[model samples]
Target: MRNIYLIISREYLERVRKKSFIIVTLLMPILMIAMMVAPSLMMLYSKSEQKQVVVIDRSGVVADNLYESAEATFIREDGMSKSEACNIYNEESGIFGILYIGEVVDARDSVQLITNSSSSMLLEESISSQIEAIVEREKLKEYNIENLDEILAKIETNIELATFVNNGATEDDGEMESTSTGVSYILGIVLGMLLYMIIILYGQMVLTSVVEEKASRVIDVMVTSCTPFQLMMGKIIGIAAVALTQIAIWALLVLSASKFVMPMLFTPDIASTSGALLDGALGTVTDTGYIATLFAYLALFILGGFLLYASLYAASGSAVDSIQDSQQYNTVIMLPIILSMIIMMTVFNDPNSPIAFWCSMIPFTSPIVMIARIPFGIPTWEIVTSLVILYLTFIAMTYLAAKIFRVGIFMHGKRTSWRELWLWLKE
Candidate 1:
């Protein structure tokens, strides 16, 4: 027990005191804060460059209908030949382009656009859309209905539907919880990916740490004092502690920056709605309370997933003398992890389907699949069952891995293969 504690302390403190760990831990929060704030700041402060378009309207009927907008200003030039307009356009510094329509504006070949340089799609689309609207309005005059344009203008609508979940409760009150499929999908993907990465990262850390110690003959010296199982357990638990510490610090920094710093970035004009925007963006996107709940489950799944994978990783590491020799083993371990990601993407659209439920019950993929499902408000039994299966599998795997470690720790230069690993397991 004391030896394991010493090993754990040495592993934890060695990593925590490193400059790389300190730098990444501090730097990641600032980068996250930038990502959250950048788009909003750009939308609020970024200005579009104004353009001036010259119009040579020979149709005479069309020039008056063309109007100015935020993107460009249309100036109608009448009583001028196309050549005269071209000359003036060539002499002008600010003339973005010229719109020329012949006596028949409806004829496609009769209309032309001349620009000082290549034109933007936005400018072309804007001009084409306005002309299309005008032609449509003129053609619709065949109906002879009065105020048709005004009626059409008034008919356009924008609707926002707020969704709620309460099993059978009324839409207005009494235990009804507001829900956003869009926001929850985003959260699910983020949390699932977070679990996926930490599992791969820290599990690989265990593998590499074991390979490195064994390669240096340090495991030889260390194993004389403790059993192979104790050494492996100590290393696994110590690194798990390191992973948890990093996650906790990151959550605190990100949440603090979001709650306090981002709101302050809003200008006085938008400061009033800043709270609402910060809370849920477009309102009722998600309840802020779910953040805590989601992260708590994230930690649980990360730890469970790490322990399960790390045991296998430790055994794989013990069987190999160098990191380069572990590639085949690494590929085998990653197969289910990759499958879990694919299943996660498909399951997002229909989280409660039989496929998702069954996949969440599988110990290999449950950490990711279950985390993704949780944001959709899955039942409590599913979460508990998945967790129990994951940890139970971890316990069984550790016992087998410890046996492999005991056999392989003293092995030196001999190359080991999967067939040999199977024989060792049997013995």
Candidate 2:
């Protein structure tokens, strides 16, 4: 055990001392911030390039409203045909586009949009939506509805009901109110991505380290001082510590950036509504409270989940003598994480559904699913149970991996298989 600790320390220090590690540890946060800010900056720059669009409204019902709705100066071409409008729009190179609304826009009516300038999807969508709103309003007017408020009130319907539980207690209007679903989605995505990147990146690191040692014949020298099991444990523990260090740095950077850096990137007039991120907020799509809780759950889930998967990756590395040998087992290690992400995507839609519950309880998938559900305010006992199961699962997986690591590191000549793995387990 003492030998393992020494080996672990050596491995950790050796990797941590590398210049590349230092560079990446610091650069990742900046890269992440750049990725987040680029889209908003691009959008801000694009708004200044708006151009005038000509509207030829033969319908006349929605012309004025559509022009105001488009929020662009409209040159009224009320009597022009589609061809005439297109010709004029072509002559004006700087104009944004032309909107041709035919009489009624009925099944027989022709509606045409002509643009010589490069097409913008956002512009197209906005125009389409505006036209749709005007058409709907016109239809209402045709039905002798003089007032939109009256029409809206007549169409709107509401009903209320209460339910009785098995204990005869009334279930009132107790629907869970969410403050921000967008925040919850971001939380789930962040957790899923963090887990994914950590597992893949560090797991690859382990595999490469093992293969490098084996290829260079350095394991023989290391074996003289430490047993295969000790070497494996040392490598895993050391890498895990490094991962923890990196994660801590990332967490600190995120907290600091959110409080200090974000304001500089975005103006106060257009501050983004996207809120706190982490796994627990996945279900809190409509609630701000969920965003607050997400960070806490995310911290716990990420810590536990990273330790769990990193152990597996390290074990996989020890089991193989070369990168080619490791490739075969990589899918097995990655499957749980991939499946957990797929499960998380649907968790928000139905937090209490049977599929969500089962997946959340399963050890392999629970770390992610439970975190995703936490923002939605799951029962306290469920969270406790999931954590306990995940803890036990981690212990069991690491112990089994350590066993395989002991024998497989020294094995040579052929690739290991499931049968060999089981045999190692028994040994």
Candidate 3:
């Protein structure tokens, strides 16, 4: 236990104190903040530079509501033909764009947008959609029905129902709970990306570390002092602690950045209409108490998940003599993770469905699947059961990894097969 602790401490400090660690830990938040803010700022700037399009309405019907719905000026040239409208549109200099509406509206199903600037794609699409909406509304009005606003409002209904056994209501009403859910969603995505990054990054680090030790003949001396079992265990645990410490620092940086950065990127209108996208990204926020509980569970999940996989990765690193050899073995460990991420991507919508339930229960996939579902409020029993299964699986995986590590680390200039692995496991 003391040796493991020493190993863990050494590994953690060695990694966290590195220049690469400091640079990445600091730069990730700044990059993420920039990514979040840049798009919104671009959109706002584009909105300010609104283009003035001239709509040359040759259709008497579409001209009926062209002025009411469009940001562009409507020129109703009823007497003029398509050729005349085209002539006028081509000659216009100050016009930002020209929309030529044809007379045979059924034949000319297309809306031609002639724009000089390439940056007006969004504005052009908006104008086209508005024209379509106006034309539809005018056609409806021709049938002697009024209350278009009410009809449109009804069409735009997006009510989400929360399912329950009894009279239980949705927990989204509370600001903190809503905030926490938002937080959970963000954290869930972050967790997935973090898991992917850590697994690949640290897994490669372990492989290179092993190769370096082997190349320097350091492993031979180290194996003489400690059993291969102890050596491998120490290495795996040590590297895992390093990963955890790095992730912890990143979490802190992300939290601090979010406090300032979220408000700047997400407007109140976007937050409200988009329904707490940033909040969901961050994860559940049930006051300070629930936040504490949620974060505690989250930390545990991350630690357990990381350690479980890291052991396999370490074992994989030890199994092969060369980096190229490790790639084939690494796939056996990585395929499940990739599949789990796919499940997580699709699990957000109807997370409590049968697919989600089973996927989250499976130890190989649960960590990602369960985290994705947490924002939508997973059952307590499901979480508990999944954690238990994961813990058990972790024990089994680590034990198998330790066995493989014990044998593989000592063997050199040799390739291993499943039969050999099985024999080693039995031994």
Candidate 4:
């Protein structure tokens, strides 16, 4: 017990004290948040010099509807031929484009944009769509309906859907559990991928640490005082603690940035730009407590997943003397994790599908798939059952892996095989 404690202490402190850890722990949150916000920020602040487009309107009806926008100014040139417009466009100094509307009003292909320089897609689409709308509105007038403009204006509508979950609502609003499957899908995918990354990273850390220790004969000195099970368990737990610590710190820093730093970063105009988008997002969230619950489960799953795999990683490490030799084992360990990601992708469409349900219930894939399902809402029994199965499987796997570890650490030099591992498990 004392030896295990000492090993755990050594493992945890050895990693946390590194310069790399400190720098990454501090910088990663800021980088991630910045990346998330950058595109929106660029769109909000980006500006283009107003383009001067000379409009030669052969179909005079269409030109009346075209208007000046932030990106462009349309100067109406009447009674001008296409060749005349092109000649003037070639002679002009500041004209960005010459837009020529053709004699045929109904042909969509007749309108041409003649530009010397490359044109923006936004400008081209805006012109094409506006002209199309004008033509459609004019064509509708041929039906001779009374007050057609007013009728069209009155009929245009956008629907806001308020989603309410009717199945097994246990929260404060027991009768109506409000939720958004879209929000659920986004949150689920993000959290699932996050868990996958953490498991791969920290699980590999355990395996590599074990391999290094064995290669240098440090495990030999350490095992004299500790049982193989104790040593393996200690490494797994200690590394998990380190991973949790790093994640916890990242969460704190990110939250702090969001709360205290974000306001300063988002100017009044910028804030207003994303205001309705944010409101729509927040409106979809029925219960604030549900998000809190996910984070809690996320912690549990991360621990369970890492511990479950760390045993195999440690055993694989024990069976080998070098990091390169661990490649054969990586494919086997990674298969379940990879499958969980594939299952997670499909959970976006149907979280409660038969395949998703079975995958989430299975202990091997549950850690990733279950997180993806929970955001869409799941039965309490299901999550509890999944966790129980996952941890129980972790215990069973650890026992089997320890058998390999106990035997493999001393068998150094030659490569280990699946048959040999099977024999060790039997012994």
Model 4 score (lDDT): 0.82
> How well does candidate 1 match the true structure in TM-score terms?
0.78
Worst 10 residues of 3 by lDDT: 279-288
Output the number of the lDDT-best candidate. Answer: 4
The runs of at least 3 residues in candidate 2 whose Cα sits more than 4 Å from the true structure, single-residue gaps closed, are: 31-49, 69-71, 118-178, 261-299, 348-352, 371-380
Q: Give the Cα error of residue 33 in candidate 3, in Å.
A: 5.2
Give the per-residue lDDT of model 2 (tens digit) for 211-312. 788767788789998788677767777887777777677666755676666556555444333222211122232222433355556656665676677677
Q: Of 2 and 3, which scores higher on lDDT?
A: 2
Encode model 4's per-residue lDDT on 1-427: one tens digit a residue. Answer: 8888988999999999999989988886676555544544555567877889988887779888888887788988877887887877773567898888877866776799899798998888888778887898899999999999999899978765656667667557556654555556667866898899889999999999999999999999988999998999999999999988977876666556655565566656654554444423333332335544666788889999989999989999999989999899988999999999998998888888999999998988999999888877789899999999999999999999999999988878999998998999999
Ranking by lDDT: 4, 1, 2, 3
lDDT of 1 by residue, 318-396 (tens): 9999999899899999999999999999889899999899999899999999999997889989999999999999999
lDDT at residue 168 of model 4 (Cα atoms) = 66
Q: For model 1, which pairs clash?
A: none
Per-model TM-score, in order, reads: 0.78, 0.76, 0.78, 0.80
lDDT of 3 by residue, 1-427 (tens): 6565655666667787899988887787566445434443443444435556656666666666655333355545566555655566553565565666776554565466665555345566666677677677766777776787797778976665322222244456443333333344554666566666766687677667776676566888877766776766677777777766765665565555556555555566655654333334322221334434544566666666776787787777677788888878888888888998988877766777899899988988887788777756677899899889988888899899889887887778888787888888888
Number of the top TM-score candidate: 4
Question: Rank order by TM-score, top first?
Answer: 4, 1, 3, 2
Between prediction 1 and prediction 3, the one with superior TM-score is 1
Model 1: lDDT of residue 337 = 97
